[model samples]
Target: MLKKAILLIVLLNGLSPIWGQKYELKSIIFEGNNEISTSRLKGVTLSKESPMWFLQFLNSFSGLGAEAIYFDSSKILFDLAALEEYYRNYGYFEARFSYRYELDTSNFNANLIYTIIEGERSRFRSTFFYGLEGIPDQTYASLIQDYFNASNDWYNQATLEQNINNTINILLNSGYLNARFDSTIIFRDTSANSADLNIYISKGNRITVDTVIINKKGEGASLVNEELLRKITGIEQGSYYNQEEVKRSQIRLFRTGLFNSVIIIPEQNEVSANNVNLNLDGNIGYMHELSPEIIVNNQQSAFNIGLGANFIKKNFFGEARKLTLSTSFGIQDIFNVDFDNLIKRFSFRDTTLLGYVDARATIEQPFLFGKPIFGTWENYATIRKQKDYNITYYGSKITFEFELPKYTFVNFLSTYYNIEQTKEVYRTNNDSLASKLVSTIGVDLGKSTT
Candidate 1:
């Protein structure tokens, strides 16, 4: 009994170190996968290799960086199955996957390798679409020509599904709100290595906007006019219901800054309904805010620091109009002076002080003259105390903004007219002053996908 007990203790000691030691997954390698990329295969697997050595080294001390991925033996089985499934999705029905692992006991790291035997890949013999009879003739033709003209192409299930989704989106935007993917049929011939694909879509009754109901919430909601909100939403009562357009409308309302939260819900009583009612619920916050800002920038190759404040009024005078008043003062070349002397340089008598001051008042309206174009008017005054000269300017600007339809080359346009009067005084000869008046007009165009 004493000898047996000694042997058990010795065995426990020997296994303790191996059980507690951690083994990181150093790398994953794929071989014989010529048709598919190795990086793509890696994405489909559950096992993940550790980050680079330097990242892991830094992560050890901070515990917040990219940490090492420790090896898990149980995930290998799932990884093999995932790789095989991924191959089948790519039309490699006869593909086979096998794996082997190498463990470095000395460094406590592991390397996993996979070998893929990709057999004959299946090609598309015929593709067809069904139950698309009621759509517009142009739309139907576009769908068939763009998506289903895939005879003899490699049979890729991923690409096939993506095309189906895109087709459904076209239908949805065409006022078929209840349109959806129904089923997919695949007839495969193993001997010929070909497939016949069929996809069906169930497009319900085309829909139109019957009415729009506004529900206001939160404090100061009553300050926003429903008509102005409707104009900003861009959803009309008698227009065809479009899903993508509704999403865009919701985004526009959020951009107005009048609402803290915006939700536009399209509701239909039945699946086959022909009309949808849009319900717009908005949560409005305080109508006014006074906030301070600390500004830092490198302007004209010199670091500048400034302090500013703004007073904003939302839904000002109704109609979703906004008013903002702003002012700021900044000092240039801050780094060239000592901290103790920085505050002393603010005196107007100190010619060595290089600073600037600005003040502005701006008013913006969501729409102009009942049209979709946005408008803004601003008046500003600025004073700059330079080393050689001191200059002052008074200016006013009028700007008109237009949002163009999507898919166009230019999605946004802005045109402005600016007028300013400048007065300059030389520091060397304080009595010598120059005055000028300037006026300018400009337009800007931009494109955005989102």
Candidate 2:
């Protein structure tokens, strides 16, 4: 090993000479930053990066992934422009920036330092509303007064978009089916460095669904149940337009993982003149994937290797159920198989488990008993062998991966475990021991949830 290390060192040193070179970045330092931390600014800069300690040390041997990086002048200039733009967007228009560097000749590495000066933040001076003459008094009251929690802090662009969506929702639920927003208008106050915002609301004619259709696309694009789809939609011929219900129903449909795309389109009903028709059109594709896997793990005290294949079906039997099947052949501590030195020939043929074979299969139904509770029923079965110990493990489990209180999910499983042992050494019952079976069944409301 010593001779090999010397040879490796000679080969590395003899190839090239790297004594004096251009300055490369070793560290970056920031000063005068108060509101934002130095790390946040570094996140957006594409030029400089801080290397991890262990990776930097490893780079000394052979540089590889996630190793040290050097400084580039072009990237530094790009980062400067990006930082100024970031400050301007965050209401720091008068921000100032400068940088300097310190170099070390031993390794041709340098430390870069940046200085920041953040100025006063801009605020929204005034807000106004228009185009609400046709809306009801209560609707209008809900719109301008309590629709937003606009504090006296710095202006945020996200707040404006949220309020606009809120206005559209309110108008839709209040029988204004075709409500929309006009272009936002802003006026800046040059003297005080503040701005004014105006949002115009348009409430169009109220309408109801004249007809509803579920159009599926792609091969094998069948729903789990037509009745289930209709029930989830929760829209009827004479039902009033409710944007909240539409949004909620769409989310429930997407959670099933059955469709690749879902789109809700509403069109005017010219014949009826007052009602509109909606189409819930989506596409579901046939899915079948199989892949081979080889895994080897070597640790301080143990080694294990396995060869396996995984098979998956996204929609099982066209019912939106998912099935996963996997099988493996594993060997653990292959060099330490039980043996008798008297007979040098291997004893693997005498039921002395030199290796083990394992297989597992599981299937999951996302919606339990066809309900919108965001729950699933999963069944799993697996078998393993401990050849050297003269024992085998066989087990099957039924699990309920379901939503708990207020939209949280938990996994609860019940398993039946069986063990088989070779009777050459001792005599014992072949019967297996498992979780106690409860044959009788009854509904327990407190223990069960939708």
Candidate 3:
């Protein structure tokens, strides 16, 4: 028993060094870590205590299956520096990290070390072009200089591709339809800390118009007016066919209101410069007029009632301006109800009153400003009451109206008045005559549809 007890004491003494040498990573607090957090670093630990913990930690480290020691950090400071570098490789150039460390000999405690460092950033400093012989040099000068000075700008693969596409479009619109640009863009660091770009352009061929054909399809096939067709074509056989002008022609024909639908197509021919065959497909429709209207008014409120009919032409000078001519007749009664009341209150209501009824015939010829202005006018006269108790009055006014800018209208009016007076209402009378001239101005707040 004494021998066994001595052996047991020796064994316990031997095991004391392994158990007492504690290595407890109590906390792995980090600092200077802008992109990564403390929790994430703590999660990377292989051990949290000592003795038996170290054995499990060794096993965990072995299970990492790393081909090299690139991820291992025995010291907290080393781990933070490694983590920062890892973030930099992923384009987090401004990333940093640090740690704190603590040692307690009596309790066997472990603390972390803090570290900080900046990361690597990959950005664009400038963009340029080369091997563009035919294009004007000034075209790219401004764009390249601007992109280079943008320091915070990153390298974008799509932007480079779109730039090439836009360059090709410019060439195509300038009569170089066969132009092409290289797919590859070369990026070089001309300066140690800056990136420079160079793009190559290929100007293939300069083409001109070889021939142009204006074809109209549909019926009244025989009734299709040649004069109108010629005006609509707007392109000659020997002239260069402008793509933009061809599109405008399509819109123009649609606005004419003569066709239900119009389409202009440019077909390429097997010529040196491409020949354009314009195929116009449309349905021709005849012009017609419909006029039916209703109006309501209160005469005491100076209101008028009117109804009319007219004919209209849709396109004037191919600019979608409407031309209209119409004849309208209306009855207007103007009176002041307040005036009658006031006269009654003043004891003048018994005085004899004179009222008039006016009838007129009008002819309107609406036109654009640059055209001649001419219209017809006439008037009729009738008497309702007399003012001098024995006097009866009649009058007529004739006027010619002209239009300017579709908003303002002007007219010249001439009036003739005849009055007859007698001692009694039923007696024969003596007459007097008066004539006057007046100019009138009118504004059309609502545009005339017809």
Best by TM-score: 1
RMSD per candidate (Å) reads 7.1, 14.8, 19.8
Candidate 3, pairs of clashing residues: 98-114, 98-115, 99-113, 99-114, 99-115, 100-112, 100-113, 101-111, 101-112, 102-111
Q: Between candidates 1 and 3, which one is better according to TM-score?
A: 1
Candidate 1 lDDT tens digits, 1-450: 999999999999997886688889999999999989989988999999899988878888987669889888899999999998898888898888888988788999989999989999998887778888778887677566645566678888888887788788878888888889999998888899998878888988888888778999888787777877888877777687888788878877776678899999989845437888889988988899999999898875788899999999988788778899999998887877456775776565565457799999999987678776779999999999877888999999999988787657999899999999999988688648999999999999999787
Query: After superposition, which runs of candidate 1 have C-alpha atoms over 4 Å from their true positions?
Result: 1-29, 46-77, 98-114, 120-126, 141-158, 188-196, 269-272, 292-307, 331-354, 407-410, 428-441
Which scores greater on TM-score, model 1 or model 2? Answer: 1
Misplaced by over 4 Å in model 3 are 1-169, 178-204, 218-233, 236-241, 289-310, 314-323, 326-450
- Model 2 ranges off by over 4 Å: 1-126, 132-148, 156-179, 185-196, 206-212, 222-225, 232-262, 270-276, 287-319, 323-329, 333-363, 368-370, 381-450
lDDT for 177 in candidate 1 is 84
RMSD of 1: 7.1
Provide the lDDT at 326 for model 1.
98
lDDT of 2: 0.63
What local lDDT score does residue 405 receive in model 2, on the 0 to 100 scale? 35
